[model samples]
Target: MTEILVVGASIAGQTLAYWLARHGMRATLVERAPRLRTGGNGVDLRDEATEVAARMGILPRVRAAAADVRGMKFVDAADRAVARVNMSRNGEIEIMRGDLVGLLHEVAEPEVEYVFGDSVRSMEEDAGGVTVSFEGGTTRRFDLVVGADGLHSSVRRLAFGPEEGALRHMGHYFAFANADSALGEDRWVTMYNLPGKMAGLYRSGNHAQAKAYFIFRSAPLAHDHRDAEQHRTLLKEAFGHETSWRVRELLDGALADPDFYFDALSQVHLPSWSSGRVALVGDAAYCASPASGAGAELAVVGAYRLAEELAGTSDHQIAFRRYEEGHRELVKRKQQIGPNVRMMVPKTHLGMWARNGLALSMGLLARSS
Candidate 1:
């Protein structure tokens, strides 16, 4: 029986634990957060990830919790709809990030051990196994340690070295939170954009609340992601005084929401996602940036492939190589879409106008087709 330690009980970590447990392997999942986090922005299941979800036996649950977003309305500063992209229920399904994580966690809990409010403090891996020290002053030895933690992965830092090829900032920042959907605009996402700035509201089927998303271009603000005060202040400075339609109201609601999430739009690029008996998965290894709109898809598919590869071989080295090989192309395609940030958060007046025009044209073409 191989004792595998998976850091971060996020979607990736949970999915990996579930698959490994199904393969008759015992895994211990550790999360720094006290418990499962809830109320995150909606994430989409697209491409091969949809099949992966079905195979995991959670596709129905995911679809049931899916946001009833009919389409997206792109608007100008004046709140007039410039374009609308009608989303068809074809190959894509959108669910709240929290819901997806909860589903994965539930599937993994009975089979795997879970430790909350703890994290890896240090790790040393050898041919025999990996010795891990936790921040709670506990030590454990496992046959393998996986860093499924997010972009700022402590496991990556401890096992792979400092943040040399770890992260690349994509020249933008995004923030989102749940709020009251008093607008009565159910089954639709409304978006307003200006030069280097974007504001949107999303309605989910599971709740009457709407989610507010704010994004802006910045030259990498000096603030810690974990600092709530700094994150709030950054968002306030970015769009605090903007006169866009209901922007003030949305920001006020966001500031009041205790569950607000703010982070830089960044990508993770690693030369190698593993060393010795330790390896990394998902965003910890290669985040394609939120601009790509494939984070959830990548996380689910990457975890599946990684666990499948590990099950195929007894040697961690071979498994890690195979996982990377299977996943590199997907990661590359997602990263290639990172530059689409300009379309989402245009930096100039002309860029904003062009984006609006292009979206309008696309919407017209879609209607015609």
Candidate 2:
């Protein structure tokens, strides 16, 4: 039996483990967090991602836990609806990130041994197996390793190189957090946009708390990605000057809430997804950025395909190559996030007005069709 080590307990990591265990391989999964994280913004399941969920027999569960948001509605600073995206017509489901991860965990955790509150400290590969030292003061040996961690993958850093050379900033930054339910609109996503900035309030009918989303176009800013307090401070500074409707209200809640997520809208574009006995999948390999709205889709489907390649042969090298070849094109296609960024946060006043006009046109077209 080939022992495998998988990093991250993210949707990608959990799904990869599920597939591997389904194929009779029990991989060990490690998450640096002490427990499974809960409460994140909603994510979408589209195209093959929906199929992947169905094949796993977890699609129903996902739908049950879905945000079931009506659609993403763009609003002007005065709080009037400008445009509403027609997600209902797409036949896709939008579930909260935490819900999807939990569903994947239920399917995976029983079959695969999981270790939380610890992480890989160092990894060295030899002919027999790869030696891994853990931060929790333990060592393990595995035949192969896979990094399904998110954009800031520790496995990728240890196996490939530092992140500075790998991460490509997509000229934006985003933040989100849980907010007071009083500000929420039931089953709707209300987004407000200003020049190069956006703020939104999301409330799923199934949940009590609303989610606050904020995004701004910036060159880049200095901050520790892991520091929640720093993230909160940065977000406060980013939104402090905005006099728009509910912007200050949302920011107040976000600053007080510790569950804030702040990061650059960036992508990982690596030359290869593998080095010797180690390889990467999902965002660790190719993040299409959140602007594409395909993160969950790509992560789940990519992990499924990578597991398929691994099962095709006992050799990890061939599996890695095949996985890369099969998945890179999709990454390339999704990473071309052109108008999506502008749609979210237009760069100039004219651009912003044009986006509103286009959204009105799209809404009109949707209603007509």
Candidate 3:
């Protein structure tokens, strides 16, 4: 049996481990967090992702926990609805990120060895295998090492290079945190924009809790990505004084939530997903940005393809090349974020008005058709 070390127990890592275990391989997963990270915004599952979930026997559970968001409505300062876009589509289900992660963990737990509260400190790849050093001062060797860690992947830095060389900034920063369900209309995502900033509330009828979303246009700022305090301060500075459209209440809720997530709107673009015996999957390799609405989909499909290739071949090089070749087109298509960010956070009042008008027309056309 091949012993594989998978860093990060999130969507990509867990899915990869699960598939590897099913292929009769031994997988050990290490996560920096003490436990599974079950908090994040809603993620969509569609196309190949939905098929992957069904193969794992978790599709029914995912459907049952679907967020069931109807559409997004743009509102003005007085909380008047300016325009609404019906996001309802066939064959796609949106589930809270935490719920999906939990479901993935449940199915993957039985066959995989999990190491929580620890992470890979360093790794050295040789002809036979890779030797890994953990943050807890432990050392181990595995036949293969995989980095399913997110954008700031330590494994990537250790194997390929630093993040500054790969992360492409998308001219914005975004945050997501728990919110009071009462502040939002059930089954709708309500957003308010002020110039280049946007504050939104997402409420899912299937879930009792709501999620607050904040996005603002900015160049890259200096801050430790891992520092929670810095994240809080940056978010506060961006929207702390805003007094329109329940912005104050939303900010308070976001600040109060313990699992608040803040990060630059960036995508990972690596020339290669593998270096020697180590390979990367998901956001660690090709993050299409949350704006693309394909993070989960890509994670699922990419991880599946990677594990499938590894299981089929003895040469890690061939497997890695096949995985990259198979998935690059999808990544390329999704990376072209186009006008998503601009539409969500219009730069001026005229742009906002134009966006609203376009959204209204889209809604009308959908109804008419």
What TM-score, computed on C-alpha atoms, does each candidate reach? 0.95, 0.95, 0.98
TM-score (C-alpha, index-matched) for candidate 2: 0.95
lDDT tens string, model 2, 1-369?
Answer: 878999999989999999998887879999999999876788889888899999999999987887877767776667777666755647688888998998998888789999999999999999988999999999999999999889999999999999998899988999888887787668888888878888999988787889999999888788888998888878878899887789998998888876788899999989999999999988898998888888988999999998999999988889989998998888888888778887778888898778777767665412212
TM-score of 3: 0.98
Alpha carbon lDDT at 359, candidate 1: 66
Score candidate 1 by lDDT.
0.85
lDDT of 2: 0.87
Best by TM-score: 3
Rank all candidate structures by their TM-score, best first, as comma-separated numbers: 3, 2, 1
The sequence of per-residue lDDT tens digits that candidate 1 reaches over residues 266-313 is 889888888888889989999887778788888899999988998888
lDDT of each: 0.85, 0.87, 0.93
Task: State the displacement of the C-alpha of residue 83, model 1, in Å, after optimal TM-score superposition.
Answer: 1.5
lDDT ranking of the models? 3, 2, 1
10 residues in a row with least lDDT, candidate 2:
360-369
